[model samples]
Target: MSPSRIMSRAIVLGFLFFLSAPLLSQSLTDEAATIDQLETRLKAADKEAVTAAMTVWVDRVRSKEAELVALVEKRSSVEGDEKSRLEEQIDALRTERDALADKAMVIVKAAKAQGVDGADANEAFLSGLSTHLDLKDPNALLTFALNWIKSPQGGIKWGLNILAFFAIIIGFKILSRIAGKVVAKTMKASRMQVSDLLRDFFINTVRKTVYFIGIMMALGQIGIDIGPLLAGIGVMGFVVGFALQGTLSNFASGIMILLYRPYDIGDVVSAAGATGKVTAMSLVSTTLTTPDNQIVVIPNSSIWGGVITNITGNDTRRVDLVFGIGYDDDIGLALRVLEDIVTKHPKVLESPAPVVQLHELADSSVNFVVRPWSKTSDYWTVYWDITKEVKERFDKEGLSIPYPQQDIHLHGLPTDAA
Candidate 1:
């Protein structure tokens, strides 16, 4: 434990360390030389020879990585000069391992280019590389990214495929629009009377189908196997259909509507307890805009389940109006006035002549039913004009229009009770 004895021990240790330095340096040099030799052979070697050389190179790289790891561990426990020296050794070993890995990757790529199966060798190289990669180091990550981008099967390939995918999709999107227009024009030019709802549905369906085909083609171009995708969609559809039975019923009703042509778009329809103009139709729901501009969306099932009165479906419609004259008024004079008012209306159809007759004699008045036929679009116009003119003409002809009136009679018994 004396100072002299400690100094002597330190001198001996220093001398041993000096002797081991050259031996360690020589070992590193030998390993580097072996790696260089293997790389040279790999460059000039055929497929089988490249494979053999790659196996040896991989084993050497693994051994060097293990040594580097041990050096790092040892350095963590030491301090000052010993830690610095171990760090230097670790850096050199790491450089050598990295170069060997680069060589192995090149060899595997070359073998693959020559149609040799380097799957096992490639797998081993990746496994070893993953172990050495410092994910936290920005420089390492950047280097890995740059390398992958430059590789044939990496960023370059996928980037090109992505560009191709978008290009195909856009091209088909334009084509679908053109196809839809063409179909629409054809339907219009042809003799068949296709309803607006059905036409819209067909155009949409065609456009969607064309776009879907394009999507499938783009997926295939991007190296995606869509066979499984379609299968998955079919299964998903089945599950969704089972869950949405009510929606399915609506869909079925929509199909029936399309086939049966009960009501077309723009028709004033009374169905599902709503009276409105048919504004839009889809496979699941029908949209109606009421007279007061309120929007209503009714399920197709409800529409098809009830009575659908398409008010404007026919070309012509009948407007029925009743006018009551006072009991004392002349019935003949009131009837003549009603006939004159209806016949003077230009919108009233001449073929289906207007009928003017005494329909009923009520408690206080004689009722005359005036029926006029006109184009469906002109029906309301005729009805309003006739009602207004009838009042004016009845006054001119000295005929009185009556309202509900009750005559109260008080009996003598009531006066006696009072």
Candidate 2:
């Protein structure tokens, strides 16, 4: 309260304030220099350089934060204009620290993009922010969460990546369908005699292949390294192929069957000891519907390895029937009757003449072979009709159909048995 004391205090206070001004200015200049160095390293765009710079920048920011906290604590002990002056200095230092934080965040994002680990930098930044703003306050925590959600390296970037991944997958799925339709149309327009089963296989294969490529692209878009994924897939395929040797054999056999076309859908064929109509075919097995309506699934390997008799491969087939006549009946009349019955059948083919001739002569009867040509589809009908007609006509014409008969001698074995 004395003039001398007040004057002395003012002189000392002015000198202290003057000293603090240069120190604050120096601190700002040093922070600027650190930021500039970080920017230069970022421009280099090297992972190691940027990462090193980020570490240095984080340490500097942490040191500056400690200084800011000290100033805040020191302000609590002051009063009047000194308190106000300290408040201004704290505000300026906080602004400078915030600028450094912004710069650090930029470096962190860039480092992450360059495949550098930014965990330390991120933790340092968040720790500084949490210390500056009381995270115990709900509003502060909400603000922090909002800021993170809005940041480029946070929720927004990850959300965009996820959306892009799904978009790529969906787009590729549509493209695959389009590709399948195009393939089917092209195959239909072409003159190649491709079977239905083969055509379907090709179309499905094309669609699946296109879809798989889309999945790979989607994974890459989501920042996944597809190179290793593809390599792993190849290795797995090799392992699976080695394990499924029998399946591979069936697959190969199926391919051969497709190429050679030993039998096709709806073809009545005798293959692998089973006689049936082919209903479906796959790379592993062939499905058949037997004449009695039994469903049979035969492995392609078995079907291909054994004999394949395509009973209805050609457009026309020959129906052979044998009839035996008694030795007393007129052979010429029987042959004429057989020929008439076969020729009169509507389903029989006219170009190849029917044959009704004496084929063999036995002790009791003569055997006549009745051969007729007909459309493959109508072979059974023609055979059945002609055979029924032949029996009736033979009976009406007084023809004797003979069966095997044995004559017994009474004197030979009777005396020994008695």
Collision pairs in model 2 = none
Q: So what's the TM-score on candidate 2?
A: 0.62
Give the Cα error of residue 273 in candidate 2, in Å. 1.1
Point out the worst 10-residue segment of candidate 2 by lDDT: 22-31
Error of 2 at 125 (Å): 18
lDDT (10s digit) by residue, model 2, range 1-418: 9999999999999999777654443333244555555455455344555566567667767777888899877867877788657656665666566667767666676666777776555755645573354334455445546655665645686789899999989999999999999999999999877877788899999999999999999899887989999999999999999999999999999988997998899899898989999999998999989999999999999999999999999999999999999988898899888888887888887879888889999877899998999999998888788888988999999998888966777675545565
Candidate 2 residue 200 Cα shift, in angstroms, is 3.1
Off by over 4 Å in 2: 1-156, 327-329, 405-418
Off by over 4 Å in 1: 1-190, 203-228, 405-418
Backbone clash count for every predicted candidate, in the order shown: 0, 0
Best by TM-score: 2
Model 1, span 1-418: residue lDDT tens: 9999999999999999777655443333243455445455445455555556455556777788788788766766787777556655655566666667765665565566677676466756645563344455465456556655765456787899999999999999999999999999999998877677788988998999999999999999898989999999999999999999999999999988987889988999999999999999988999999999999999999999999999999999999999999999887878777888888889999978889999998988899899999999998899899988987888888888887898999776634555
lDDT of candidate model 2 versus the reference: 0.80
